[model samples]
Target: MRTTLYGQFVAGTKTDEVKQIVDKFKQYNVKVILDYSMESDISTSITASNNVHKSSFNTELDESNTFKIYHPDERIFNTNMFNYIKNSNTSRELCGQSSFIAMKITALVRPLVLQKLNQFLESRITDHNLFDTIDSLLTTKNDFTHSLTPNELGEISNLLLRINRIIQTVKKNEGRIFIDAEQSYFQTAINKIVIHLQRLYNRNNLLVYNTYQCYKK
Candidate 1:
């Protein structure tokens, strides 16, 4: 049953299986866009401090249906993505062309952190010192009253490191990556991450592309 369901939509669940599928597509001159469909496990949560005002924004989610405030294990997601890129690179080497990998930023960073960061970015979008503000947030070890907690800041830094690793790996292997867009609520944060990556990787040409889901608008 599981095989029948996912087979229709996904390439494959295993690395070897997916690689075989990509190889088959190569025979038809069709390139593959590999995506790890684990982003649905990502969820939003409300801290105890925010519970007082949760009613105002409908921030409370069903506890049983959601993971913890932040997804406790990001390494699993990172490893999966890294392996996908490595495998895709190997396939590309055999095919002598670029293979695309799509990433959803929500899978790397918690939704709550993104929500807070997005709020900050939205309020300061037009500020002259916007990049400076981002730099400060990324480097600051202490939590300001209006800023993220120390733990959340650390997580964000770790996320950036992991993302940079993926970007560097793709660049080294002569491949490209696409950042997949999600709902409008999260688009600002997603765009910020993609822009950061573009500035780093899209130097000579457009190696990284951000998907614009026009249907949402």
Candidate 2:
């Protein structure tokens, strides 16, 4: 019960057969963090795309007929398929199974949306990069607004929905969601959207969590 670990000790670390562990921790009045160790479950990929892997990936896949040999980008979502994750995580969370979701804004929002928002943030009051540059981006469906190819556009759209769904889940269950940060080259871009989401969703409290990687110059 009285543990000692600096790093965030994930929930599953205690072990699935945790009746004794739970009882011991309860005696000590210890708090617990929800961390599902289903590393294989969420937005991850199965490596070794050989016949075995290919056959395995196809197992239980709904689109059996549509399945074909495709590149990784085509097969998987730019940041883990949203529909698959929504269904998977939703079920996992409901089972009192997984908690403490560590996700990325990049996984959900299109890079170009961040790019446009970052660009506007840098413009001076008179820098004349019309507000639409960023404003429309927020209002419009980011999935269809980018200059990427048709297939790329669809992939990007999946990410937007994935983000929306993730937030909806966090909001529904009052769960904590952490949005991890990246390099300085991306802070502004990440910040712009994160703040927007914060203001939109985090009015009462810090709903959209943003990580600041402080190792940069």
Candidate whose lDDT is highest = 1
- Which candidate has the highest TM-score of all? 1
Model 1 misses residue 172 by how many Å? 1.4
Please give, for residues 47-85, the per-residue lDDT of candidate 2 as tens digits. 322323322332222253332322333334333544434
RMSD of 2: 8.6
For model 1, where is the 10-residue window of minimal lDDT? Answer: 54-63
TM-score of each: 0.74, 0.50
Superposed model 1: Cα runs more than 4 Å off: 1-5, 40-71, 75-81, 84-95, 132-144
State each model's CA lDDT, in order.
0.64, 0.46
Worst 10 residues of 2 by lDDT: 36-45
Each model's backbone clash number: 0, 0
Off by over 4 Å in 2: 1-75, 78-99, 106-135, 138-156
Q: Could you give candidate 1's per-residue lDDT for residues 120-198 as a string of tens digits?
A: 6676677645554345657544333376765566557666766777777777767778889886667877788777778
For model 2, name the residue pairs that clash: none
